[model samples]
Target chain A: NAGVTQTPKFRILKIGQSMTLQCAQDMNHNYMYWYRQDPGMGLKLIYYSVGAGITDKGEVPNGYNVSRSTTEDFPLRLELAAPSQTSVYFCASSYSGARGSSGNTIYFGEGSWLTVV
Target chain B: AQRVTQPEKLLSVFKGAPVELKCNYSYSGSPELFWYVQYSRQRLQLLLRHISRESIKGFTADLNKGETSFHLKKPFAQEEDSAMYYCALSGRGGDDKIIFGKGTRLHILP
Candidate 1:
């Protein structure tokens, strides 16, 4: 099964343009997240959803929006793209539970590279 | 505020040599720590966690509460071990979101 799938592996957008980064998971996980990684920087949480119909903002949620309509899909939308938005975006999913000894291992997609010019 | 830090931006070692990637974190309460690795052209995946207290792929990490460090170590570096490693932390209460460090790029010379 495809653990997690992200579309538009690479995209280039002009300033002020808007686009959606699609994410889907087949694991039926209850938690999904969107993160962006900049050069020499760690992944910063953009948005997250605990379950369908529930979403919340994370550390770096500015200029982004997310909606969890179903168990399989959680997409991130950029209202107005800027140079600051250029980075590698990753979609991840994890099961919500007691988090065993290994803790919750979040599965990530291959990542979507977005370049805003 | 909760934060994770990977001091080294890049680390290089020869095959069969021991390696260590330094990581330090700051959190007031008990925190869950994790190590995530990204191989060439692949998605980032979990390597190990402090809670597991187990080794994976010949690599191990120990959390030192006094020093607030969770450094990753491997006895013998392998060519296949070359990758980017990130240190992350999760808070016990409040928002259970994970925070990651800048990451260290480890390169093993064959």
Candidate 2:
């Protein structure tokens, strides 16, 4: 059972290069999130989606973008990549009831290691 | 704004020793705290949450509103328990996003 899947488990890019980190879930979860983990910064939220066609910015969404056109897919796009973007990115999903009234536990995917040289 | 603070960046304990990982948060809404663990070369996963008031893998956490802390504790730590621990806080509502603190790397020595 694939809980949450992220593509390009490892990647390297030059400064200013752009790429999209693909993320998808098979659990029919309504909430999806993208976060970046740095050495001392912990995990910083980049973007999130509540459901199909609904997306919002998180704590650190400056150089990143995300789309939720369907329930099963929520991809994060990074434009004009920079050195600070070199960190492990994680995609997570949770199935809270309507308005997230229940089951707030989030499931995380094996992270995508990206290095912006 | 919400914030999670994990004081210790690295913790070393002997096998079978009682271990405690400190965690503090600053949030005004009803607090929803959780402890996440990541073993060496493994993905991050949830260990326990205060709302459940339950123990997992011999670890438990209690939410203290007055102190604004949710520390993870284990009476007898095993070598297998050596992993990175993170403390997190949820927004007011359940579905709201979560804020995580810098993780603490726990090393259980023999």
Work out the TM-score per prediction: 0.87, 0.88
lDDT of 1 by residue, B9-75 (tens): 8999999999999999999999988999998767899999899899999999999999999999999
DockQ, every prediction: 0.55, 0.49
**Steric collisions counted per model:** 0, 0
For candidate 2, what is the DockQ-based docking class?
A: acceptable
lDDT of 1 by residue, A1-117 (tens): 789999999999999999999999998888899999886556778899988999998889999999999999999999889999999999998776547654566889999999999
lDDT of 2 by residue, B17-105 (tens): 99999999998788678899988756789898887789899999999898999999999989999988999877755446666888899
- Residue A98, model 1, lDDT: 46
- Cα RMSD (angstroms) for every candidate in the order listed: 2.3, 2.5
Q: Can you give the lDDT of residue A7 in candidate 1?
A: 98
Q: Model-by-model lDDT, in order? A: 0.90, 0.87
How far is B12's C-alpha from truth in model 1 (Å)?
Answer: 2.5
Cα lDDT tens digits, model 2, A4-102, are: 999989999999999999999999988899999875446778998888999999889999989999999999999999999999999999875523334
